[model samples]
Target: MKIELAENYGFCFGVKRAIKIAEDNQNAATYGPLIHNSKEIARLEKDFKVGLTDDYKIFKAGDKAIVRTHGIQKQELQELKDKGVNVVDATCPYVTKPQEIAQEMSEKGYSVVIFGDDEHPEIKGVKSYATHGALVVTSPEELEGVKLHEKIALIAQTTRKVEDYMKVANYLIPRYKEVRVFNTICNATFENQDAVRKLSKKADIMLIIGGKNSSNTKQLFKISQENCQNSYHIEDEKDLDFSWFDNKNLCGISAGASTPDWIIQNVIDNIKSKIS
Candidate 1:
């Protein structure tokens, strides 16, 4: 069985940069885990005294706070700064664009509607950008029975699926008076998902490697499962079950934006070795 791998399925630019900064400033206490991957976070925590917390109480004196690539809420940022926290912002530039757009729309007296998971770190951060409070909706159904303003601005989470974003956008366009769409889905996310779609076509079984808690990883797993029923989402080699690979001919491997290449390679190597 020949294994196929996605060209654009691994750690993205945002994740790479964040990890590099964490390593360079090993002593600095990051406000959150630099990225979502537990493996990387574990490694960093071991070497660096990087502390992860949303609470402001832990920060004092010379302690520096590093923001994750997903970004942080405006109020949180301000509060940290006010507390004399030395902040090293690692927010991805692409993720910051939607926040700026939402802020502009809110300042112009338009109602901002963020189309993404509300509880997600990125969405929460984007909400802080709006001068007026922004509304977050995960899907069209969530907006049901709710009255929309005449002038509304729309933005998406950086890791959202493009098709899903369009579905929600089209659903609202007809109901709202004025709607502005800003495609904020990260380019790396789109490319990674696109690569998985391409690989799924040629492979018999698909393996999505990433942290199970990772939203981007879940999205990738869902995308792969849609195209191939034999797809499995696993964090590491230990999560792999031999039964899932029984009689499989070819396996395609892909990963999320936050997943490190070393982890992906380890999973792939383990799976290949199991092939009799």
Candidate 2:
């Protein structure tokens, strides 16, 4: 059996930036999980003393509050600032682009349409920026029969697949007079997806590693599964099932943007030990 790793996998620029920010601001609390990987968050907490807080109100006036990479709702951010908390923005630049686009386009009287899961923290924050409210949908069918303005501004969650986002855009372009589509997908996501897709096709077994709640990780798994039926999404080495690799000639491994190299290496090491 052979083990192969995807060309582009593990911590992306944004996740690396957020990790650095968290390290620099020891004793500060992030409003949400700094990134999707719990193990990395635990590592930061243990080493840097950085804390996680679900409620923004818990911070005192002098306390430092680091914004999560996914960002927070506009009103929640404003409220935190109004309380005089020392705010440190660690929001990914790619995520911020959609938020700005939503706010600017909505103010210009364009109906905002976001292609993403409405319940996702990134989408929730981006949607909150739309002055007149934004419609969130997963597929082109969701836009069916929905009455939108003549002019529409479409944005997507940074981690969503470009193909899916295009389906939403294609649906609107034919119906509306003017539809402005913004490519908000992160470059790292594009690379990781493509790499996994390619690797999965050649491997007998594929492992997509990252947080279970990570949207991007799930996307990678989805793509891997499409190409290779024997695909599993695992957080770390602990989640590995050795039986899956039985008689498998090639094992492909890809990690999400938020996943750390340490975890990926651990998975590789464990697999090597078990199969050697």
Candidate 3:
């Protein structure tokens, strides 16, 4: 059996920065899971005494609070500061860009259209920045029956595929008199997805490592499946099924931005042990 790895996988700049910030500021609690990977979060809790909390009210005066990489709503952040919580913001710069854009464009009288999951923390946070009405859609079909303004501003969750954003942009551009589109998908996401797409075509079996709830990891798995029928999404080494590798000449490994190198190495080692 042969092993292959995606050219760009695991520990994106934002995740790395968030983890380091949390680690350096011991006894601080993050606004949420600092990153999507539970393994890394658990490690931080155990080693650095970093904690996680979604409710800002729990943070008392003088308590250190770290904003997760996905960020929180603008109102929530303001409340944190008003409460006297010592905030160590770790919001990814990429995520911050869309939030700023949403606020700026919406204030300027543009209806905002964001292409991503509405329930995602990033999207929820971004929406808070919009002063005008905002629409979140997974597909262009969602725009049906909705009345959008003649002028529109478009952005996406940092991890969402640009192709989907493009689809939504195509729909609005023709219908609206003026449309401003910002390709807010992070560069790291594009590189990772492209790498997986290329690797899956050549590998017999594909392993996508990351948290089950991780949006970017799920996207990678979906992209891999498009090119390879045998693609599997795994959280860790324990999730690997030896049967999947049987008679496979090449197995490809790709991980989400939040996945740590240790987790990826364990998956690789476990695969080698099973195949040997």
Better candidate number, 1 or 3, judged by TM-score: 3
Writing each residue's lDDT as its tens digit, candidate 2 over 1-276 gives 699999999889998999999999999899989999899999999999998988888998989999999989999999889999999999998888999999999999999999999999999999999999999999999888899999999998999999989999999998999999998988999999999999999999999999999999999999999999999999999999999998899999999999999999999999999896
Ranking the candidates on lDDT from highest down gives 2, 3, 1
Per-prediction TM-score: 0.95, 0.98, 0.98
**What is the Å distance of residue 226 in model 2 from its true position?**
1.0
Better of 1 and 3 by lDDT: 3
Tens-digit lDDT string for candidate 3 (138-205): 99999988998899999999999988888899989999999999989999999999999999999999
How do the residues 1-276 of candidate 1 rate in per-residue lDDT, one tens digit apiece?
577898789888988898888877767776666788889888888877665776656877567889898888898888888888888888988888988998999999888989888888888889999997898988888878877678889899988898988988898889888889888888899999999988887778999999887999999899898889999998888998989877888889999888988898898788779876
TM-score of 1: 0.95
Q: Name model 1 segments beyond 4 Å from true.
A: none
